[model samples]
Target: MTANPLAPSWLAPPADANDLAASVWPANARRSAADELVFAGVPASVLTERFGTPLYVVDEADARARARGFREAFERECARIGTGVTVYYAAKAFLSSAVAEWMTGEGLSVDVCSAGEFAVALAAGVAPARMGFHGNNKSLVEIDTAVEHGIGAIVVDSPIEVERIASAAERHGRVQAVRLRVNSGVHAHTHDFLATAHEDQKFGISLTEAPGVVASIRSHSSLRFLGLHGHIGSQIFGADGFEESAARLLGLHHELLAGGAIPELNLGGGFGIAYTAADDPTPVDVLARQIADIVASECARLGIAVPRLAFEPGRVIIGPSTVTLYAVGTVKRVTVALPAAFETAPDDSTDPSAHAAAGHPEPATAVRTYVSVDGGMSDNARPALYGADYTVRMANRVSAAQPALVRVAGKHCESGDIVVHADYLPGDVEPGDTLAVAATGAYCWSLSSNYNYLGRPPIVAVKGGAARLIMRGESIDDLLARDPGIGSATRKASTAPAHAEPAPAQAAAQRAS
Candidate 1:
């Protein structure tokens, strides 16, 4: 089979389009004897039939295992240096009450960045001391809330946040533990938008300013300094950036020891994961050992004791444990110009002789199929936001047809509302086919929106052949319930004629079902 000239260089024609890459899917994902895709023993067809299309299916066992794996890996490595490690599940990746419970049950702390996340964790019964609050622009109310709840540690992003946290702690008549976030100037090999520790980013204060901020934090009677926090970026592949950042942070940590005791150091987590067959992310255990050695050696070089460690891993734990399932709504094949590097001999169908007879020029072209799904940017915006690439496969059943290059699109109004940028699916893919996008468990739901009035999908956790809704999908009514005009009109029209029909959104939703 010839490779598609239009496909990305990193994408290769698979030996079998139906085969699932183990690294890019949940641990329990497999093709059953019936050729149906199953996650955690629940078939994809069963999940879509029960939960509807455009659903987020998470493998409960896979997620829980990752959480436990991270905790164990870090603990084991840090134990070599006579120190302990705290693994904080970064809630910004994907958080629900069930996920919060799962993480905590695995003995991992929760790291939340906003008031809503903090509230969700609290409601899920996550201990206040096991939750760390983080945000660059945390409002006074947020600080007050964190202090009121006696949160574990508030990561202060700027110098002013130190005072804000201190004021809030003073008001609560308690001393709050705080970590000063600093940019170690390590340029991680990642997208510019994902890199946070670069000097010009919005996330943290400069390494030069961190010392003064730490002094100010210690000056406050209501604040206890918990050392420094540094995050390089998201979706990072190797530990080179982490090692460099650790070396820089340790330099600061050594200097800070002159002032007072700094017990714990947090190297924020941006560990990467395999999103496609082309990705080879460092395993968690290997990453733990590599980073542990880097920090230990750096501390030894600086003649400073290794501080207790903390990490905030979000995507690495949750990203590969779930998949987004969508129903194909349309399929269109369009002729596109092939790259010059991929130019080939003119076939009879596209030959200059046939073109001349038809009054057209011979073109170096290839057919690219665009498979439109029931959902798009409204459900997963990573493609539009970061130009993120994802892999897709026919989930309802396996196919024996030849592989065809495909662009999985969404039903949104925008042209950029792509789901999978480029991948190969069975040539027979058509409307009503269930397509599953692998490794969508991280930011898809967390960054979802209501663009084009599309209702957000639900997240279902499947385990032991049992599926349970961890988060309910939003309906049209849920979207309209917040509109003042719609609510008022609905209430006023309640006394109208009995033959009146349902709202347009409701009717469309009913027809969709």
Candidate 2:
């Protein structure tokens, strides 16, 4: 089968549309003897039958292994340099009580950016001393809660946050540890919206301003200044950005150490993962060694001891460990005109008079199939939000049909509701077929919404041939229960399991009660 001109240059027609790339899928993902997609030893059909469509299936063992891999790799690398490392599971990627427990069990700390995330970590019984708090605009209440709970560190984003955290620590009669987030002025090679360390962003203070902020933090009697923190961006493919950012931050670290003890240096996590066949991210172990080398070289050059290193890796650990299973609802193949670059040149053999009479040849066109699924932006918003690309496969069963170029779309009302912008699926793909999108474990669930009134899908953890819900799917009653007008009755009559655990807010309120 020839490649379609409409397809992106990076997307090639696969030899077998049913084949799953090892780097883009969970370690345990495979095809069963019956040709059905099996994740963590459970068939996709069984999962959809039990949990319904648009379900998130996370490989428990895969996630744990990745977490352990990061911890061990960084530990070994940093140890070689006579220093230590802390791998914080960035909860903003996707957090559940189960996930928090998994990270803690793997000897990793948790990084929470909100009170709700903090509450979740606490509810999971994670030691507050191992958790770090982060937010550009944290409320006073949130700061107070972090201080009162004895958080390991609160990454101060703004100058005002220093005073807020200091006041909270004073009120709680505790000495709080804080890290000032600084902009290293390193522009990571990534999407503009994702690049954070650039000076124009809202994330951190300039390198120039960081000194004053650190001074203010040191002035506070109740605050312990840890060190500086910086995050370059997400989906980074190489180590150059980390190297550059570390060089800049290390320079600042050297100047600050002269004033007082600076024990830790946190380069926040934006590590990338393989979302599709086109993505080839650096291995965690290799990346760890590279970063360690960069930090060691910079510190040695500056004639300073290497500080304790910290990283918050969220996506690389979890992104490829899960897949979203969607039921195909519709399939429509439409002929689209190819761009001018793809158009064929006028034939020289044709006479000028004949060509003039016939006019220019009709624009080249190609067929693109739109495969609509039961879910959309509500379940996975990356495609619509970041214009993220993903690869899809026929999940319920495999076929020997030729590969067909497809655009997997969501059921949402918006035209931008896409799941996989471009991929090859079996030509026989049609309604009732179940499709799986790989590498959705990261921000998908955390950024999911009720757009078009679609309830969020449940996340199920699969391992050793068993499946269990880590989070329950939202039902219609769950959505209606939020309405003040007609929701009162719905809330009272809703038959959803009352045994389900409370959300962070509910948990906090329960503690108060």
Candidate 3:
């Protein structure tokens, strides 16, 4: 069958529906001896039986390898050019105590953007001095938390936030290291919402305002101005944006240094990763070389010494190392009428079925299949939030059936709850089969929710043919614990206890289960 005209331009039917794309999948993922998809030598069948459906499996070896690659590549490039560099794992992509520990063992720092993220880093035994706190808006309590813990640097997003951090630092009797985030007005080629340094976003201070903000930070004795930082956007593919951002930042760095010395400069991370065949991401070594060359060239042109450099990569490192496995629940076929003349849907009706039922005239009808899975946007909100595209493959077994264009949907009531908008699956795809969605390791779990009262799925890490749960699944009781209205039963106790109640040991155990 030919590619569907209604599908997005970037999507094309593969020669073989069963053939997995190597670019988007984890490094260790491949067809096993049993002809099934395996991650780190463990088959998807084994994972499904042991952990059940709607499971997230991380190839631990792949993740560590990527981390090592980034660190080594950056270090090598910086050393070749005689510049120092640090690689900070962006915690916003996905953070767990174990993951943080892995980063620590790999000799990488962390970039945290919230108090909770900082707490997670602390819980994982990561030194506070190795972490950089970032966010556009930092509440006084959060600023105090960072100051009290002696965080390495707090990336100030606004002039007002600079004052807030300074006040908190003074209150704690500590000198806070700070970096001012500047919008370079460079637009990266990506989704509009992910583009940060485009001058209009809520992320960083505009280039025009950054100089004044730096002076404000320098005015506060409690705040130590580290350097200037610029992040163009996330999921960036080309080095053009990085180079442009570096040049602009270096220009500002030259101006800022006339009075005082700047020790460090941060070119923020928005490195892109392959999510589907449409995406072709730059290799870590190549990206490092490109960035190093650009920074080195800028510094040479400006006749200034290279400052200590750092980058926070969250998606590129984590995105390809994980896959989400969900079980097919239902498959329904529907007839869609092709639009006449302009290929536009009627403004009066948004529902295809409703429009058809109304007996509207049409040129032709196209039959499409909807494969519904047990999980939806609650576990991975990227699809609903940003229309993020993902690739899907049947993981349990191999088949020779012809390709069938299908839309993989979630169990949620919302019509926008789609996982894979368009993908070619085997015609024999059916219920009880395991479907693996590749390149979901980045933001899916980090942005998951408990919507519709459904428990968040557990994350399983696979290494050396071994599988272990890194994070346990949430239970109904776990959700109930936060509800104050419900005590021992559905309702609160009628009488108050004279003594403090024993820690809900049984409830805790149930949640663990």
Candidate 4:
């Protein structure tokens, strides 16, 4: 098959379809002597036999290495620059008791955005003083829970939240450490939805409003202002935005601390990880040094004592440590009409899927293979949600067949439920073959759902040639257990919208009754 016009320019055809790119795959993923894909000494076939298809496999060692890398790199950089640093594992990426326990063992703190995540951290034996709670709109119960637990820092996002925390802390007879979240007004070069630092987003208080919010916290007897925090956005590959965010944030940090001492400055994490060959993520050590130099330079120039620096890198640590395994169920060949918008399409496109569509004639269409897998948007929604890209490989065996342009899709009914929009795969790919998608360790499982009523898959941890089910897949019984029986007399009908009317079947049943 010829080169695909729909394939983005950044995507190059793989020399071998069976080969997995090192940047996106787990550190320990490799092919065994038998030519079967092996991860952490466990073969893909063995994992499927035991855990079933559509399973999330985490390389325990890879995750630990990443955790240790970030911690060590930051500490080393901070020491060289004569500053202190703290590395927090962002639990929003992928969190479980085992993962949290590993983080604690590595001497890393946990950053959570919800009460459930906080509880998980505590359950994993993470010290309350080592946990940070972050959320733009936390409920009163969540606030009270954090206060009662003596959380290390509650990143106060709004002025109203500062008051809520103060009240909650007073009730608990404790002084809470708070950091005012600030928007630096610098937009990160990423998907617009993921770009945060801009003032228009709903993440943090504006740069203009932060000083007053800080003063409000200082007035509360039950609150102690820890410092200022800023998170530009996620999947960021460059240091310019971090430096910019820090420069603006430190100006405020310097101004506020000159009046009163604040000990910490948290530049929130959005470090990027490679999802495909097109992605080039900054190495942890390099990123650490870049940030360290920026902070060191700023503090020295301002003639202020260096405040403790902190980071909350979630995706970078876990994203490359895991892969989603699916069992191919069906394969089809479909011809798609080339839309009129691509009439002037360049032979070298930056992103092949980055095209506008207007219906074109059937003669201009192209035929591509569609490989359907058991999992879809329910397991990994990034593709559907953000037009994210991922790479996949045939994991069951090494095939010598020539590569073909293919689209890996989910079993869901939605046409947009694509896992891999376009990729080169072995032409011999078939049903029952195991397929693996790279860099899914971050948001895939964390954002998974039971859409189409499909049971969620399990997570299997692999280390030292051993594979264990860290989380069990949902069963039909488990799904139904939470569902109130449809005919239950005690069940009350939920209030519908005022403009809503009963369905035809429901109205007919009501009339018959």
Candidate 5:
């Protein structure tokens, strides 16, 4: 059911694995004649040399392509199924003024789960009416801010939030359109997405009580019920999950109408994206078809008019469109007894980071790669959080050297702060070589931190021969500013230890999983 480490992944050898896989890389990503990987034609060497190690590079084209895919999916599905669709790019995946413009420009609306995210959208000139606010435990201030800004609609989770939104909207002399986030109790099969539905995690109202919730919304003259929204989970691979969640939601919609509540229904989005070679995510067009099919069929079965369909996708669109470029800071080799249990494959094993519902195949890893970089969990937490392995390659130069066994780690002061669990990098791997990791533009930067007082990297959008900074690199002064009180009391951690790097552990935990 899962790939064996001994067998390499299909995209093995990695000769051009460093070359931007246009499908997974930014639109402008390419390699220069000098063998330097160019994002938007801007060389990786230039980025690291100018900005230093652990720099964040984005392809403007990649970001835009994802936004456009969502827009196009909605449009095409609307034309086919006749049910209106609104694609809301979830800001939590990765939000920035520059990215906000890209999403809105593609005709996609923004989904802000918090006041801070809303502020970013509104500040970026995203129209208030194009925003859908959602949060389970929204702060009173967040609701107040959303209402004050007149966001398109606030997806209400709990009754407390409803009362707050009502009061806030009333204060503004406006009835905020509200959507009830209903949990359908579907055990959405996913890694990061499963907990959202465990009833233990803070999220939507349960499906059984959604009618009463809808009734309450209808009773509030100050509240306008836009519809019912259901997000089962995230990183979903196909439409079966969507169809099931929609079916449950449509039944609730029918009951609401019978009780004299005609609210719009939103089958929320949690589409998956490929983070590795193994993932085979459905195309936006295919996803659109499935969504439209469910909505149309459900509307007919329930004898209810089709309401506007809405989706919130953060990863699906952004995941493949970006990759993280890192420079190999060190390489070490060690030997340890292979776990006897894993020496032979587990009969029904799984990779937690693999896109849900995708096919499984073996990987070629006769020799695995253990490559360490200057960054770790402090930069990209996915690998350490979900055992998310990545495909890496030499970007700064073409290497004829054989791929070596390696484990990538970060400089975070934690032993568990690993990056790629196992990957193949050229045996010639050295401190100066550039290592390109695909599908990183989504979660990597958004979740990065400044552990060990290490400065965060600058974010640059690469397009052939042109790179612009969206977020600037953190300077030593920026780090010092946080601790003016400690500047005199603190000294950089012992440099001798920094120089005498520890040998890479042979059997490090798969922290990403």
Candidate 6:
């Protein structure tokens, strides 16, 4: 990055802005003579003109293929190691009864982090035993519901959670299987991972605190301690991270065995998928083989049996399968100079270059390409949250013109709300044309909100020129559907975590005290 120091390595100057980059996009995505973006053989322009702008078009075949890839890969790798394996598609990435049915039909397990997700899975007809209930702060009622439903496993994040789950399981007269989430403190990048002795994350119990929980759960007849689980982080493209995580988790397993404890092992997924040229997420088959190899060797070294492997990858399985199609609402060409970070940063630095434009520093007197679309932070918040970068193209038409450095933005009121940070676009890009942002199928819709009171985009599944609506857009009336009947009064909005259940506040006046 010429201007920014921390620019991601995958950002690059596109050789052809009009051409489709196959790695980050669906296999069938292409540009047609009409200059329209086509996915699954349907033109995005046609979809927009038919369905309107700010729509999410999922390549149904592609999504199914990705889910199958992970399932088959893990199955094959586990067979080679003579061990058991399971791939739990994290439902929070993007869920619908439609998607759940597809995943279940392909033989993949479902991992739900919330009650709403569990409800969707059941409504979609996925078997209860194939569902894995996961959460850091699951309510007692949630645990009771999962126990009553007889879901597969509840990943235990804390000892208190184990107690609640055990109590709920006992009340139901069922022995609930549990996995302890261990914070291994492994910091992993795309190509490198370091296993540290101490971890400082909020999600999991310390290694020291975990064994006691395992021992505690072992004492409870109503609960079954199935294994150890560790999720290092997300968007990792290399095997070394898994290797580090696996070896460390097994090391703990060995320690547990020495204390007469034999448990399964769950290495949580952050397996990377390419969002742009900067990302090189490992293929599912290759990554599974490598991780399986690591676990096998580690078990041999520790003189223990190889434990079953579990993965909960949301991005790799669903990310590349879908793309967000948007209509260019406004196009703004801004004059900007390259920032010092991009120009001065070293090549090997994994830092963000505040001035990087399309993997390089913004040049002095550079004409930045800023295209505004109908959706912003409401549709996808990763960019604004992590300063993440993305790529977009002229989806409605093809341009045989030179590429210009541009930033794609949304119509939200926040100046900080941007979609594609910096990328090359054909100079002639304009309004009324369609734009398809790549690698959004994972986090975009899953994290979408009603910010600015704007309607959330509908998710439409596209297959063989046929499209079906999965989730309809919200209306103003839908936004106010739950309003209280207090005359001339409105409750103050709460700052609860997104996607988490709402924490409602009472509006009672206490009868004037």
Clashes of each: 0, 0, 0, 2, 31, 24
For candidate 4, report its TM-score.
0.89
The global C-alpha lDDT for each of the candidates, from Candidate 1 onward, is 0.86, 0.86, 0.83, 0.84, 0.71, 0.78
TM-score of 3: 0.89
Clashes of 2: 0
Off by over 4 Å in 5: 1-23, 190-199, 261-263, 339-369, 484-513
TM-score of each: 0.92, 0.92, 0.89, 0.89, 0.85, 0.87
Candidate 6, poorest ten consecutive residues by summed lDDT:
502-511
lDDT of 3 by residue, 251-323 (tens): 9899989869899889989889988988887787998999999999999999999898989988887889999
Q: Superpose all Cα atoms of candidate 3 onto the true structure and report the RMSD in Å to 1 decimal.
A: 7.4
Provide the clash count, candidate 4: 2
TM-score attained by model 6: 0.87
Please tell me which model should have the higher lDDT, number 1 or number 6. Answer: 1
**Model 4: lowest-lDDT 10 consecutive positions:** 495-504
When 4 and 5 are scored with lDDT, the better candidate is 4
Deviating ranges (above 4 Å) for candidate 6: 1-10, 258-263, 338-364, 485-513
Q: Residue 346 of model 4: what lDDT?
A: 30
Cα RMSD, each candidate: 4.6, 7.7, 7.4, 8.8, 8.3, 9.6
